[model samples]
Structures are given as C-alpha cells and as structure tokens.
Target: MKRKSLIITLLILGSILFANGWDVQEYPYDLYVYYIVTKAPEKYENLIGSSVVAVTSHRHGDFGNAFNSSCKSGVIEFLENEDFVIDKMDGIDSTFLSKSFIEKYFPEVLCADISVSKEDLSYIWENLSSKYVGFSDMKKRGLNKKKFNKIKNTSELKALFDKYMEDCHFDMKIREFTYYQETAYDEGCKKSKDQRDIYFEQETSNAYYVRFTSCVEANANYFTNLEAVGVIGRNKEFIILDARSNYGGSNYVQEKLQKILNLEKYKGTVIVLQDNWSTSSGEVWSIFGNEKSQFKTLLVGTHSGGMQNYDRSNTIKNDDLNIEISFGSKYLGKILPKNYLGEGKGYEPDIWATTETMASVLTGLGVDVTGITFQ
Candidate 1:
C-alpha cells in the first residue's frame, strides 16, 4: 500500500511541474497494433431485401492503379532501402455522407425482394439510443440477417434507406453538419486558464509541448463534441501549441497536428502524460520517430497504450444513408519497442512519474498560476 501511494504522489507532482516551466526530456517506446476500415455505395437491393458489400476509397483505387502497373513495381525495388518503410492511409471519420445520390442509384424493389424493415435498417443509427437494434442486433433479433441475403445489388440498398428515412422521420444527424476548416500549423496557441497564475509565468516559443493522458474511450465522447471545442489561441500572448484536454481527437488529426508542430526544428520539450488508455493517435504522435528533429519529448506517466490500428474501408450499398464501414485491417509493426529493461509492456517514460509524484513536482515549483484551474 505504501508503494502504491508513492506512485500516485509522483504523477500528481509531475503534472504540477509541467504547470510550471521545466523540461526533463525522456525517450518513448514502440508497440504493435492495427485498425481496419472499409467503404462502399448503397444500392436498392440492400435496402429492400438485404446484402453486405465490402468497400474501398478513391485513395486505394488511385494507388492500386498506379502501384499495380509493372512499371510501379520496378520502382519499389529501387525504393526499398533498408531505412524505407511503406504505410499509406486516410479518410475515415464517420460513414454518413449523403442520401440523394443513394436514392438515385437505388430504387425501391418489390415487397417480396427483402426482409429487414426499413425501420430496422436505419433506426439504430438515426437514434443513437436504438443502437442495440442495429444490424448486429437484427441478426440476433432473427430478422435482419435473413433479409439482407436477398439484396442483389447496391441500388436496392439505396432505396431502402430513402424509404426508411421517410417512414421513421429519421434524418441523417451526421449529414447536415459540415466539418470546420482545420487551423494552419504556424498559428500560435494559447495557454489554458488553469496553467496560468498557478504554474509558470506566460512564456512564448516557436517550439511547443503538449502533455496528455491518452484515453481511447474518450473518442466516443470527444469526437462528438469537436466543433464546440473550437480553436484556442494563447491569451494576449504568444504560445505555439494549445493545451486543452491534450489527450483527445482521432489519430488522423493528431498525426496532422504533429507534422504541423514539427515546423522549423524545435528545441523545446513536447511532454505528453500518458496512461494505458493512451491509444490510436496518442501512441502515434508520442513515438513517431520519422521526424528529423531530436524531440525533447517527456513521457512522465505510465506505459502508453502501444496499440497501432490500421483501417480497412467498409462501404454500405443501396442506402440513402452515406455511411462507409471501417474495420481493423492489419497491424502496423510495434512503435512501442521492447527493451532489455522491459518487454511486451506499454511505451516507456523517460522521466517516469506517478499521480502523486506529479503533485509533489508541481508543489516544488511554488507557482502562481493566475489563469489555470484544477477542476
């Protein structure tokens, strides 16, 4: 029990230390995991009777066309230097895209054509609460799986969604929303309210640090509220990277943010406080060694979730609902590497700290964080 208390004390202290301005850089580890993704168009058949279609994106199509050519294969031989590794992926957020085109492609079929009610087809997605009745549930309900087998093509699937929407008063909640324009990387960030006055005096640098506790489950809630979060810049001062929650957003967004922060060689600490829940983008941004700069990254928390998920596209056909399926495909080899010190563990922390340690570290700083808060 005493040992456990000691661990917690260190983490709390570490957090406080960061609230003040000090940098004790550390190393990151690598681990292996993979995610899958899929995409496709809806058809009338899928809606009326039932069917499942595997999907791909324009990215795969273009790349396959280019890479499949014998000439492209020859280029691969030359490019396969010992240091070179190939990994390509993009475009998987929510599946919903649009409905009109789906209907145009797929018209209603004879009632004899399919089984899953238009009600069962889309109700779960429209009302997130009805999720238990989702396609997965329909099979358990003993209605949907049997119905989908009859869906001969994508067009039929499309008609079903159109009718489903009209019947259940279901509007695609995702369709109406537009994604905000991503902020440019060069733009400065603002210090959070909690950090100021209590932590360090406001300081500015082109170099930046963002400490975080990666929580994959956070995505289930965080991504849903992204727009409301909005862009935050430093107050009446110059900060390069903002520290909001520090531990959210999809891996794709974080990957983009990492490259953006990599502008001009950075010499400062980019601390990310991680726990086992630190996954997806958290893992990628924490230990991506591809960058040229020697990042003064501090991993002061526990072993990070070293799961790296690669996505394979899944597309829905014959439905007005514009959702593409994404499932786990292959695992990217471990970014969280094993060492003589430890193996099959989470990412290593250079300046390891527990929650209690973090508290003490902050206490030692004797900061006057006027603008920061603990809650």
Candidate 2:
C-alpha cells in the first residue's frame, strides 16, 4: 500500500514538472537567451548583458509558430520591453511582401514563374532581397553582398534564388512554408511490420544491418530494438546503421543507444548511412557512431541534414496569443564543433555514395559485399 502510494505521488510530481506545455510564465524565448549565456557561451559570451532581440534575429527556427500575428505581437512586445528596437516602418515596409500582398499581386512568384515589372522588382529587392541573400545557405552558395547588391533586375534575383533552392539540400526560405517528406533509401526492402521503429537483420555472416525508421521516444520498442542489435552484432565484423530519411525525434534515443551499443567491447567497424534527409536526432545518432563511439566508425553516403546544432527543445505556451513556441535550450556549437553543421549545411561523409552505388563503395573500402543485399 505504501509503495503504491509513493509511485502515485512520484507520477503526479513528474506530471507537474513536465506539463502538457510550459506556461506563459516559463517563456522559452527568454530561456533561450539564458541558455546561450550560461551553457554555450563561447562566441556568444557578449550576450550576457546584451538585449535578447540581438541574438533572436540571427537564429532560424527558434520560434515554432512564427506566423501567428498574436504571437508575433506578443514577441515584439517582449522584445520591446527588453529594450530591443523595432522600427515603426518595419510593418509598413514588410506589408508589401506579406502573404496576402503576394497572393493578390504577384501570385506567379509562388510558382517561381513570375516576371514582374522593374518597379515592382526593385521594391521587392529593397524589401526582401537582403534578408534572402543573408541566409546562411545563400551565403554558402556564393551569393555575397557584393553580388546581391550589384543585381539590377528581377531575372537575376530569380535565377539566383531558384539555383540556391535547387542546390540547397536543407530547406532555407524567407517567410515561406516548406515541407519535407522522409523517403527510405531502399524502398524495395520493406521494414518488418512487427518491428516498425527499428529493424535489424544479419546481412552477411560478418555484417549486420540495422535500420532506424524513427527515433520518437513514444515508440515502446526503441530501447529493446537497440539492445537486440547490440546483442546480435556483438561479434559481427561490421555493423551498418541506415538512417536515411530519418527526421529525428527524441534525444532519449541517443542516450539509450549509447548505453546499449558497447563499442569498447565490440572490436568492429560501425558504418552509418546517412543522406540529406537524415536530420536532427537522426544526425545526432550518426554523429554518435562517428565521433562518440569507441569502435572504428565510418560515415557513408552523402552529407547528413544539418539540424542537430540545437537540442533539448521545449515548448512554451503564451495564453494571450494562444500559441506554443518550441525552442532548443542548448546550443551545440561549442560542445560539438565537428558535428555543428550549421543550418542548411549537412555533415559531409567520409565516403559519399548513393543507394544504388553503396554496395560497390563499401566493397571498395574492403568491406565484404558477397551475398549482401541492401534490402
């Protein structure tokens, strides 16, 4: 009776500590500033006494529901209270490039098939082009201030933006909604229906393959699946981790994997397969295999989606705005500089290969490919 009572009390305390969402009082926007100041305060050490809004503008995806007008107003108010400057003309200038304005006047820009007049183009260039060109991905794509400022017309801007969009693996857009569909590297090899989150099989006598479809903490089999892989592949010469198209979930998965996969005892190479589709926690897993694991690790396939720089994401709700903003509590730049593949920049692999050519690539690396199929 006493044990049952203790368990119930603990459960209640846990629920209270981790409520559905953080109340408005526990504002994550402010907490993000505190975290940057205390935890990862290398380059951002000056932020200790600086205004929160200074750092906020430089970050991307810090606020989850940024489109909500009420939320935006609340955020602006919060920044203003913290002595952050807000130009009164900002709203007026941005009104011309808003979603409603674009839909009504320049709908063709939505489809990237628009040819606007010089006056309209110049207006857009003055208002939106600076922000777009300032994007990290755009800068990485060789779009510099000199080149962008020199552009005289809409055609050049469109051409540059289009090319950047095409070449950039990670979606980077200004005030535009982008959706990514996770795709499996090998569609023919269907995952076992019984084992949905993780699937493992001995591809060869010396090699074992494990595919992680999702890393969501809610998946009951996450830990067990990883434990099973550790037990089964203890003596295997090679362990292949396929994380293609895995758009990460919980860091709990990373913790569980670290404990289960005892790389120190296992004398074998761990090969992680990743692509541009593998992001966030998926990239975290790949980084663990390559940088954290005690075993010999090799990162294969193309660059991994770079979205693991920030972690410990928590949602904070604002009752006034009726909005929940999810923001990361920790910045990983100082902690994991090697894996700190910035926004829209993926982790480059040691061996780059596609799904079609992976087998040949591995074989060339002295990994036995006899009777080993990708499926």
Candidate 3:
C-alpha cells in the first residue's frame, strides 16, 4: 500500500513537470479564447460596432499542456458579461487550450511572466524560442520585465509617465515593437480609393455602372460613403446599385439606411446593377431595399452575393503580452435568404446587364433601359 501511494505521488509530479516540461524555470500559464461580436445591445456601444474576430493561430498540442494557474478562472469570469461567445466553451478544462480544434481558431494566450525571483521569462524564452524568431527577440522586447506598460495612443506613449515599474527600463527588445491591434493590415485589405471613386461615380452618376470587386464590410463603407458624397452631388448623380461584390456588413447600418433612403431626394426611380458576388450583409441590404423602397428598383445585373448568415467574434482572453486570443465565433441568423439572387443557385438580373450591356448603357443617354437585353 505504501509503495502504491508513493507511485501515485510520483505520477502526479511527473504529469505537472511533463505538461509544461522545459529546462527554463518559468513560463506563463497560457489561456486562449476566440469569439465574434454580433450585436451591441447598448452595453457595448464603444468599439467598432458589430465585427467578426477571426483568431488565426494554432499548434498541435494537447488540451491541458499548461494549466498550472488560476488564470483560466479569471478569463472565463471576464467574458461572462460581454457580447461574445465561445463555439464549444465548457469548463476551464474544455475552455483552455490543447492540441485541438480550439487551437485551430485560437492561439494559446502566452503570458510572458518574469518576476524577480520567479525566473519565468528565461523558461518562456526557451519554450517560445521555436515559436518566435530568436532569443534576441525576447531580450530586445524586455521580456525579462515583470510588468510592461503600453500606451494605446501614440501621443499618449510620447507623453511619458514618470512613474516607473520594475521592468520599465529593461533592455529594449528591437523588432518586437508593435501594437497588438490589427490596424494597417486590416485597413490595407479595405477597398482602395480609386475603386471607391469608380463605384461611386458610376453607380450614382445618374448613369449605368457596375462594381468590379468588393467585400461585404468594405462595400458597406463604399455604399455609405457614396451616399454621403451623393448628398453633396459631387460624384454619381444617380447610383446603379450593383452588389455583385458586396457580401455584407453591419446589420443595423443596412436596415437603418433603407428607412432613411425612403424619405426624400430619391422618391422616383433608380437602377440597381448586381451579380452573384453580393453576399452576407450586402444581400440583406439589396433585398430589403428593393422589396420595400419607394424608388423604382430596377435590378439589371445578376443576383447579389449569396450570403445567408454572418459569424460574430470577439476576444475573451489574451496572452501575457496583453494580446488577447479569440474563441469560436457565434454564427448570426440570416438577415435575408431568399433575397440572395445568386447565393448558391444562380443570379438573375432584371435587364440581364452584362459586360457588353454595361458599356452600351454608359454610352447611351439616360432615357429608357428597358428591353436593353435579349432576356
């Protein structure tokens, strides 16, 4: 009996060591969570209204490879009240990271903990060496510091706070200086100025025009910006609503705009050019407006991008670096399903406006585009 007890004790110790087994003395207890933000029920009225957060990092690891702290409890508690969701979040065990599907969507939030006597940074440095570029990367980033301060606004960062933390002046980690938000990268992916101009001018210019490329969210920006510009009568005097590139964006923005549009300035007729590319929020906007707008909705292009539902996301937990990790996304309901002229089935346009038709429409004067195509 005594021998068995000793064996069990050894096994427990072995498990702990093996789970986060590394020669380095300390490493943070990592946690990961990914979710999407669908609605802003008055509580979350700040951050960029409803958006999808896609957690893009994963490693083939077991579930509880590093659960040695109360961090998991802290995180779960934090996310309990937010407008976010976990795809399959259960308890701490299920909620934590391992070599599972969870990792596929979310990365293990790494906390680069390095207390004075704790000696965790060294261990973390060694453990993450393979993941990062080099140990110099850790050294340069002051990973050895117990706590690092970060200022969100650059002006704020420039206005240095005299107060100092334990690791304030620690050796600077070069090349490791970067804000943890998705700024330039995401913005770059948005539609270019030229593209927006063309779409705006052609669509709203009282003439017939079509959009070449578009994303659901980005296209939402395009449409809204175009309306703003149209209010000033700067670009397209009339817009050809071609959602061929629109997949969709914020639900509220689309719905609210429809109501506002029906009021004035355009109580007559409008031509909408679309195709199969219209998706997500784009399809919803197209369907709702066309079906219930005061203007004569003439769909000349194909059906819009077939978008049934939208996936919501958010960050429930972040790494030691204060970089949060997102959990699974909460899939939202379809704002418009049947409205998808060519989601999966096929897109059918009113005038069957194609490449040739578009050219001809642009050349001819704005009169009657009826029977323009041979059905």
Shift of residue 336 alpha carbon in model 3, Å? 2.0
Return the top candidate by TM-score. Answer: 2
Task: Give the count of colliding residue pairs in each prediction.
Answer: 107, 0, 41
Model 3, span 41-100: residue lDDT tens: 233333212222222211101123233332433332333333122222221111222222
lDDT of 1 by residue, 1-375 (tens): 999999999988986644442111122224311111121223111121111111111111111111111122222222222111122123212111111212222222111133334453454334332332233322343444334445443345445443321111111212221111111111111111121111122232322222232224533433332221112211212122222223233454444444544553344445444443333344433333334324444444555433342322222322464333322323333332332112113366555544435434433433222443232
| Candidates in descending lDDT order | 2, 3, 1
TM-score attained by model 3:
0.34
Q: lDDT by residue for model 2 over 1-375, one digit each (tens)?
A: 999999999999887644421212213442231111111113323333222222111112212212212233333333223322211121211100112222333344344332334444344344334333234544577766556655554455556666543222223222232212122222122111122245445467678776675677645555456656766777788888777655667656565555556644778877888765566777754446545566677888776666654553444433432323233445454445455455555677778777667789988876766665552
Model 2 clash tally, residue pairs: 0
Better of 1 and 2 by TM-score: 2
Span of 10 residues, lowest total lDDT, candidate 1: 178-187
**TM of each candidate vs. truth:** 0.31, 0.46, 0.34
- Model 1 whole-model lDDT (C-alpha atoms): 0.30
In terms of lDDT, which candidate is strongest?
Answer: 2
